[model samples]
Target: SELSEIHSALKEIEELESDNAGAEAPKNLAGAIKVQVDRVIRAYRTLLGMSGHAQEVLEVGENPDEEWKNVWLLLRRDLQKSMPRGSELEKAWHEAFNVDAEVAFEAALEVRDLAALMLVGVRYPFAPAALRATKASADLAFAEGQRALAAKGYSALMALEPFQSVSRQDLALAAIKGYLCTRELGWRKAEGEFKSWIDANPAAAVLWGEERKPIGALLLDFEKAIPSFDTLELQLGESLVSMPMATLAGQPSKAEPKNLETQAWPSLKIKGPLSPRTSYAMKNLLEVEVSPVIPTVTPTSILVNTGEALYGFDFLSGKSLWGDGVRLEAPRDAFHYSEQDPNLILTAARWQDLVIAPLENPLSKSTDAPKAKSSFGGSVFSHFPVVRRALVGVDQASGNILWTLGGQYRLRSDQASLPDLEKRIAVTSFFTLTVVDDVIYALGTTRENESQLHLVAIDPAQGKPMWSVLLGAGQGESNMFGNPMRDAMPGIPVVAEGVLYVQSNLGAVMAVEIASQRVLWVSRYEALPRPFTRIRSTAYRKVTHANGAPILTRDKKGNLLLIVAPTDSRFITAFDAESGEVRWRTQTENAQ
Candidate 1:
């Protein structure tokens, strides 16, 4: 009987222990079940710690192998049972932990996942907050050379959260800075991000107006940020529209449209003291001839024409000398002036004939005044030997042309002609020519393509070609106008210090050696696909020497004052001439 009782007692004890374990579960218990779940999690963490591989193995998540799923389920159930109702901290903690677990699980499941982790975070509730912290931490780590840690942290955060307004702003800025520093994102991506930011933040529009970067790029952003219709309307009203005017019948007339026809009117009346009659009388009677002739002696007398029909006058006295029947028809483009010679006057006739005349001393008015001479047989410059051929030369004291050259060239019988050479050689209807040190340079496209640029140097003395350089061969494909047949043409080459500086419509500025015909250096404006297209046109002022280097200027807005000089490494630097440093740098949000 005593043995039987002992066995029954032992059986009852075993049953009670089993029931107690079952009751501890969340489904069975009403309160304090969290303690039991906490105990289990602590045990598992301890096991993880002991193994020294918990971080590595659990990188994907705490239960990466799905073996921890049951354990997690148990813990979660117990914690839910243990938590009090309506607890915000508990809710937040649950949400955060759940997201973290999901991220870990996904990471562990796919070792070769090519998808972005940050993109995954977009679907999670707590991702935004987590990502912010992670990004900040990663930034710090990157600075400290902890690359692996930083990367891991960034990936994890990206996987855990969606981007928020503040975070997106930060990312956009980072992207911009990265583009500036590494040029990795490229102009297109950088521009897109900048645009997105501006669109989202209209009140913060001033940030987009920073002129540190290329103006073309900034202009793109500005256009997107500001309403184009309103801006255009404002500009039109300010510049293109005219005010109403009173009619001869005493009724007011509506403002006339500003167009070619209106602008081309023979006479434009203004409401001022300078009326039609007074202006015409004054212009005819008191108009001092503005001469196109500019003459300079070795060091003394310099005579200039004031365009008046009177005889040539001394530049200092304005007194007419050697009055003659010769009168200029088109005062604007008919005459060529040379300040280097004071006594000689040169002019071209409507039919392409040139004449050289000498002026007498106005103070004397004696018959001994210098006699005028003429060289009027053929085109002076042989290349463009026919009518309208461009020419520049210095005349010898004798009645002969000293040195005359033309840009139009003809291929010899044995030499193959470039099919496009004529097109390339053909001068634009409107172009300018400049002569420096007896070498003549011409700027304009020849006939082959409208954008085709040819820079030809001619020997003014022999009417022979010295060198010719072409720019913008492949510019057509990249042009915005979709004209693939076009190319970047050369503007007038500015000569200084034996170096010929040339600007191209393709955004390249090149310096060439006059003697060797070699390219010394080249720099480009990198903001636009074709930055030159944005420029209405280019005009170069004379090069001024500063600090033993030549500084060049262009009329382009930001590039108005640019410096071009050689560096110690044989490289050329183009920066702001005023600052003597690169001025077009800006701080973007993204920097790497």
Candidate 2:
């Protein structure tokens, strides 16, 4: 009966708190509820042989001395031991949390004196039930604007693996609020914590809406006062990225002319190499891939995948933000670097916590096709190693793996239909994963036909499939020796104004409507060499990895032009974006 009365009083206090009553209201409610809890604790203590421990706690009201913390520790142990498994007090505690979180918060605080008890190493049980009760109570504290109490709750929850998923974001948010609410601890610790949260969830830096500006202002003040050059640099860079492009450029750049007639040039000019220097230190190219297509640029940070590990670094500082380098799955091959070979690990895309990368066979000395077997079995070609897929999602902040969506290309040759064995080949390849409107689209292929390709869309939020469509047979590829390796060019998917353009290795380009996922149009061309062109034994060609990636550029009239260069050829075709109509076709003698 006393337990039920105390629970009722606790519930009433929580209801007032939930109503967001005046500041004095909670203290008044807690004060009244505290008296009842004291009586219950006293009764329970005598029954559990814990007399005289907390007698002073009740007599002195809420101003329990430091000794009260130890009293609670002994009282909790004896109370749990003495109370029957289904005692009224235990039932009350459970119901108080389940029905009214405020009640649980008040009750737990009044009896165990949470903050004071925590200082004395007195903690609730770590069992799942205990964890849930603690979390529920802590959540109420946050709801009531009790920053310190909420931070304590989050700290404990973070240490428990099972609760980490639920607690991490809330804990981060709570830490931000706690830092703002108190200056008892040095501002450096608070400032560092606030910045850490931003790095962990860059997207969340502006999560507070109108409050974001104030937070930014506070951070600016800290930056000015703090002696850390790195922190100031980071804050400055963050501010710059938040600015509009026009503001950063000083003046708005001229936009493409809406109705200017398209012009044709005689040849693509070789102004300079893509990089300022023609040579690339393979060791430092985490962003670049085998495909000639350039890496995606992030304004504030650089994200790169070196096959073995995904790395995030501060663009300004050149310091690593996070990486799984210590636990590398496959180290980079020293021989390939010595030989100036194209690194096989390709970084697909990086956006906040979502990083898409694909790892291929790193040990392959060459991307060249195997030589055809000599007639009469004079010399048989070696078996091609199985090609595996290594597309994966990594959390950029923590360098933790989110999901892996790649596999080795294989077929059921044993149960083969005649066409199956003829076309079945295990070829490992990395397809670039593109994100459009929060949906992830990546190219996939079947061994049955190199010309055939699949466009797979996934929900990057959870790495789940949204839809997959076969875009029909396109083209095939060949080795430098002009031998058929596979048909179909594996071009990176490019999105322009909600339309996706994909190219098969052989040179069939198609545009798909992003929203409807429908093929808008298909354009085919002879992009690969028709007959075998023998690559003479020379070092002029150097590394033989070639990707016929389709390029998306705005025409003179502001319309997107899909330009594609045929593999091993000098012909380039530009197609109208909306209608897939050929805009212009050109050929050059010495350009690829």
Worst 10 residues of 1 by lDDT: 378-387
Residue-pair clashes, model 2: 16
RMSD vs true structure, all candidates: 25.5, 23.0
TM-score, per-candidate, Cα-based? 0.26, 0.41
lDDT digits (tens) for residues 1-592 of candidate 2? 5456545644554454446433333334444534544655555545434443333333434654443443454455434543334433333343433334334344665665544323322233322344455555455555655554555554444333332134444555544554443321223454465566545554444335455533444444544432221211112422422222111001111121123123312221211112221111221233322323233334444555444445565544456666233122433421122112232224357544566766543333344223445546343334332334556677766767677654434434563553421222223244555764467777765544445566777778776566666677645443333323553324556665457787664456788876687899998765544342222211112111244246677654346788877554456788887788888988866755
Which stretches of model 1 miss by more than 4 angstroms? 1-314, 318-389, 394-438, 441-444, 473-492, 504-506, 526-573, 576-592
Q: What is the C-alpha lDDT profile of model 1 across 462-551, one tens digit per residue?
A: 544556666435423321212122244443345543556655544466666666666666666532231122121112211111112234
Give the worst 10-residue stretch by lDDT in candidate 2. Answer: 245-254
The most accurate candidate by lDDT is 2
How far in Å is the alpha carbon of 234 misplaced in model 2? 15
- How far is 393's C-alpha from truth in model 2 (Å)? 0.4
